[model samples]
Target: MFESFWRANGEEATIVIPGWQTMSYFSDVSNLCWFLEPEFAKQIRRLHGLVGNAVVEDRHIVVGTGSTQLFQAALYALSPSDALQPIPVISAVPYYSSYPAVTDFLHSGLFRWAGDANAFQGENYIELVCSPNNPDGFMKQAVLKSDTGKTIHDLAYYWPQYTAISSPANHDIMLFTASKSTGHAGTRVGWALVKDQEIAKRMTKYIELNSLGVSKDSQLRAAKILKVISDGYEFPNSIDAKFFDFGRNHMRNRWERLREVVRETGIFSLPEFPSEDCSFTGDRTSSFPAFAWVKCEWENAQDCAAFLKSYNILTRSGKHFGAGLNYARVSMLDRDETFDVFIQRLYSIK
Candidate 1:
């Protein structure tokens, strides 16, 4: 959907990296693995401040190849090393599908997938809280209230384009990725804002063992992109500025159009989100979620993904996200032509 937008403003988003630049694996003087480039860190802070999406003060920034790596690092950092039993990792129902796999794939003795936090009764556990959640674009909070439980806030889609920047997020551990925020999925850069130094160090160690560290080239490119976004805010009226404005407007338009199509179908339903005041935009706006959580209401179309697939519209099955087969997720971030095709197929359903 944003292909035209990017094509029209390509020059402003372009970055040129010298071949010899960032040849070293090391990103900073800290010698610590998972070291974030100072410029990258600075740019991240600047971007957050400009966008009012996340709180950065008094936090240790740990960069990763992407949030996927950081999710593992968070599990490593939060789980006790000497524990006799595997630490339980959990999230609420309809959670991000990758959490279970990311937590259990290593078969590490330190942690194990514990299923839904809402159903869990464990004392010591790590709960992943996704606000403006993955499968469903709704705000979420920790369901487990155990004193021994630790929480990692995944604020990947918390940008103004996806949801209102309600406030600067302050948590013990918070994760953000470039993919959802700036549409830089290939950059493979994500960062965790950690409140504790020890946890930060341990997460860094996990990154060290995992891939040695994030790519410096990716970091530099991400920094440039973030800087461009910040500059857009600084000079809102500039010809090449206001990337977030463009993104938010485009997303809102797509959501409205999709809703119109779904309404006409009468076989699918979508979640309703109330408009809220955005700290970044200084106005009230409804959510323009990255994905559409479509629920099939027809008896014959019990499997939402299969139902959509029958119409040549592929989607992510809700069963993958711990929701029932009646639900499915459709990406709203595809190219305009693809989105048009999806809408056409969707409205054609009888």
Candidate 2:
């Protein structure tokens, strides 16, 4: 989706890295997070400031290999080293499937995967709150209400393209990724905005021990990409309309097409989201989620994903996200050609 947008600008968006440039492991030896490239940090803050999705002022910016690494870093930073047992990590049902998998993959001594924050037992825990959530794009708040329970806000899909920015998200720890934001998954760049300095330090330390710091090359590219995006909005004659405008319009059209096809089939249902006044767009618009939460309404369908597969359209069962087998997640972020084929397949599924 964003490929064309960047391509339209041509060399205006290109970056060149010399063999001699960014050779040092340390981007800023003066800062605690020495690996953090100064340019990347600046662009991260500038983009956040421009969008007003997350507060970046006076907050420590911790970069990662991607949001996946940042999430693990959060878990490591939040869990007390003196604790008698590993702290339970949880998110609500219909959460991002990777939450549990990533938390328990290593069976980390710092934290362990605990499914569904709503059913979580105990006082001390780490709650991952993904707003405009994955699998089903709904706004979320921490379900566990204990003072000892810490929360990490995953705002990966909180951009104007996905949902209305109700207000500036003020959270202890917030996570955002280039994959969702700019469709730069291959770049493997993500960052966290931390209000607490110690938590930021611990997260940075985790990256240091894990990957010996993030890739300087990736960081530089990410910085360049982000600067171009922010520049689109800041400078009117610089290039095109806001980078998000391209994303938002494309997503809205996709959602409309999907909903119409689902209605025509009458065998599937999609969750309807109420429209909200977006602060950025300054218009009342409904969220056009990057993922469509489709549930098979047919009585004969036992597995929604399998049913779609039989139709030669691939999908992920909602069971992966702690939902029923009747429900499935269909990504709306695929290529235009692929999406057209998917829609046609759904129409022929009778």
Candidate 3:
């Protein structure tokens, strides 16, 4: 049977992620302020430990509207003066779209997005690296070893899907959130692992001024749920037994189905999944949890996105993600039936 990159194989099904339990009460009634328990705080610290560097200290957990808020704060903290000589934000091509957005929002006059690192002239800039990156699931090897520099690794998808239990720390300020890992996007809980004291202090100050020190209640809830997921062990239970395995199988199957759809249809293209090195060993085709990036040469990325929307299928076009406007991103997290539907629609592209 022929396959395309946009479809899911196997059983037809409908699926929604059953991960976060924190948002249940909000449906019934909403309250202005929430309360927190002490134990919950302790557990959050433990969850922080799971993804944190053992040697790194002075870590503080602050609940954000989302990690996006922290990203803005980081930009402001590292912002420069003068519009012409703005602090250049260096990021890999095809990065998280918001890297430039948050930078522009917070300090538009003082900062600008610098796409390539090689073209950079000097050492006075901030590099935002997203490991297990958004558009493509590629993680960087390590940050450039420099004392005057600060690197923030957005490990938003750093859970069992892409990383090992003992993956070494990649950068000074490693960002992690409960959204992608535990499927708790509603909690708006995220933490930054900062190795620099002054930068860490600045982040704390920004949080204090930004949202009044993040809700202790939300932090506690996020921590409590994290402890339950963490169980008595270091890794989350999601990976211990067969949860991670099932996810991997499901994702790989989805990717294969999608690949077949693309190969057979021949309307679009894709990045050949790279071979696994010791640092990253997983199914290359479907290793990513939520989405896969597609290389579409014939259509503008925005036009492609609009075309998919006509079929009632949503996709993230790459125009906003970076310089490339010829690629699109589609999620593999949908149900089998939805994937099949997507594939069927994809076949109609040509």
Clashes of each: 3, 0, 9
Candidate 3 global lDDT: 0.59
For 1-350, candidate 2 gives per-residue lDDT tens digits of: 67777777646668899889988889998877889999999999898888889998789999999999999999999999988889998889988988988999997888989898888899999999999989888888888798898999999999999999988899999999999999989999999999999999999999999999999999999999999889889987876757889899999999999999998889999988999998887989999998999999999887999999999989999899999999999999998899999999999986
**lDDT per residue (tens digit) for residues 1-350 in model 1:** 55565577667767788888877767776734346888889999999888887889988899998999999999999999999999999899999989998888879999999888888986899999999899899988888887889999999999988888888988899999988888878889999998999999999999989898888888888888788778777876775667778889999989999999888889999999999999998989999899999999989999999989999999999999989999999999998889899899988896
The positional error of residue 189 in candidate 2, measured at the CA in angstroms, is: 0.2
Model 3: how far is 166 from its true place, Å? 6.6
User: Among these predicted structures, which one has the highest TM-score?
Assistant: 2
For model 1, what is the C-alpha lDDT against the true structure?
0.88
> Which of candidates 1 and 3 is the stronger one according to lDDT?
1
Residue 87 of model 2: what lDDT? 93
What are the clashing pairs of model 3?
3-260, 3-261, 4-258, 4-260, 4-261, 4-262, 5-258, 5-262, 13-337
Q: Report lDDT (Cα) of residue 253, candidate 1.
A: 89
Model 1 TM-score, all chains together: 0.96
- Candidate 3 shows a clash count of 9
Return whichever of 1 and 2 wins on lDDT. Answer: 2
Cα lDDT, all candidates = 0.88, 0.91, 0.59
